[model samples]
Target: MNRRESLKDPDDLEFFDRIQKLHLSLDQEFLNQFQRSLPLNEVLIDRWERASRLGFGDQTSIYDSSLVLGNVQVGKSCWIGPFTVLDGSGGLSIGDHCTISAGVHIYSHDNVIQTLSSGRFPIDRNPTTIGRNVYIAPNVVIAKGVNIGDCCVVGVGSFVNKSFDSNKILVGQPAKCIGEVIVTDSSIDFKYF
Candidate 1:
């Protein structure tokens, strides 16, 4: 169904249009206080990243609209892109200088089987860890308990379900080491074969 047609109030539609034109942004302070007030359906374009108060480290940035849950610990100089889900409900820790691209979803719990079983099966919960200088590309889905080492690049649209060593490029579903990453003093390169 079309969103415009679904709205019952004319004023609501007007407000939505006005916000679209104005391109307003919500800062970290506002988000923390009124997180529950934000609508889930609206397309959010938030650019607000603060200090460790919001579960981030020094020089780390996370969109105000992003959904971050649980004991998430992020180190310095990390860039968590917009519309990402950093679900640390179990536990999550990320080291310095990591880049989590837009539309990425990192979770510490899985309820796929348990949801279908109606409490017959228990939900799996685990801790997730990301090492220093890791790069997670757009639209990647990281499952529970996955540990990503330093200088690793997770390619776009990959579904990572397992742990990997450092300096490798992970790609494809259930992600594989399709390449390697080399970092120098001035440049970071990916070698694919």
Candidate 2:
């Protein structure tokens, strides 16, 4: 009757059915646990598989919708969320156990000078580094050459343009250290200023 019902290959229909079922299961699980749904591309592409294909470290998972450019190095057990951008054209390194939230953008180069001077100047390139055990909240942007030290927390929607030492909790637009992170064997504390 319908075109799908009259498909030439039964295997194609079966494959589509399997994908739908997997998507539903994943969606339901996410809804129950995180009160969210999986993105359509995420349903089709396995995050860990994609990360493995990109040569990320063991146990690291990057969402299918995330864009990763050249020379990006991600360490073990990191979670790179959907719609994030990792611009590694100038070299970007993210250390172990980091959580890069959705909509976060880490840049290693910028064309500000070149664009402002109408191509008279070259694009500035620099390395960006994120140390171990860091958490960058949603919609945050880290500019080129900024090094975020270990055990740090970057608040949501902050624009980080400078380097910070370890155990800092950074917030605000030109992100500043508003707190310190104290890590113990079994607990972690944030001491805000």
Candidate 3:
């Protein structure tokens, strides 16, 4: 028998079988609705359970493939998607109702100077904060010391290196304000520049 087969106890075998069944069901459902399959870990662990384990606020869900480092504080009703990195070695705070999309990386520290200086220079550390109701798109990177204000939408694949005010639509390499978000009771709109 194979090494894997020999190592499996009865309980382990049963658990693996259940996991396989769950994956199939979930994959079918996801394909029907979104034309995609659920990530393996997402099929195994409930998102809310993972969030609760990390002390995130109520109703926040962080994917199993996301990596969250030191001193990160996330508020309620936020969605942290798969393959993202939240580097909080210098402290990071994300406010309520935010969507940190897939492949996003937010850093609160960097070792560029240290590495270039052959360990003579110390790593840079700074706080990175994301305000309430922000939407950071897929593959975006937010650097250390950047504070994004409330209701901002960061476009996909953008690289944000500076702070931005509330209600801005930001995009591009060193993301620039390209539009504004207008919000009123029962209505919301985006006005592009």
Report each candidate's C-alpha RMSD, comma-separated, in the order given. Answer: 6.7, 3.8, 3.4
Tens digit per residue, CA lDDT, model 2, 119-142: 999999999999999999999999
| Candidate 3 Cα misplacement greater than 4 A, ranges | 1-19, 25-36
The candidate that achieves the highest TM-score relative to the unseen native structure: 3
Off by over 4 Å in 1: 1-51
Per-candidate local distance difference test: 0.83, 0.94, 0.94
Against the true structure, what is each candidate's TM-score?
0.74, 0.85, 0.86
Who is ahead in TM-score, 1 or 2? 2
Tens-place lDDT digits, model 1, residues 60-174:
8777657888888989898887789999987989899999998999999989889999989988889999999899999999999999999999999999999999999999998
Q: How many clashes (backbone N, Cα, C below 3 Å) per candidate?
A: 0, 0, 0
Candidate 3 displacement at residue 132 in angstroms: 0.2
Number of backbone clashes in candidate 3:
0
The lowest-lDDT stretch of 10 consecutive residues in candidate 1 is 40-49
TM-score of 3: 0.86
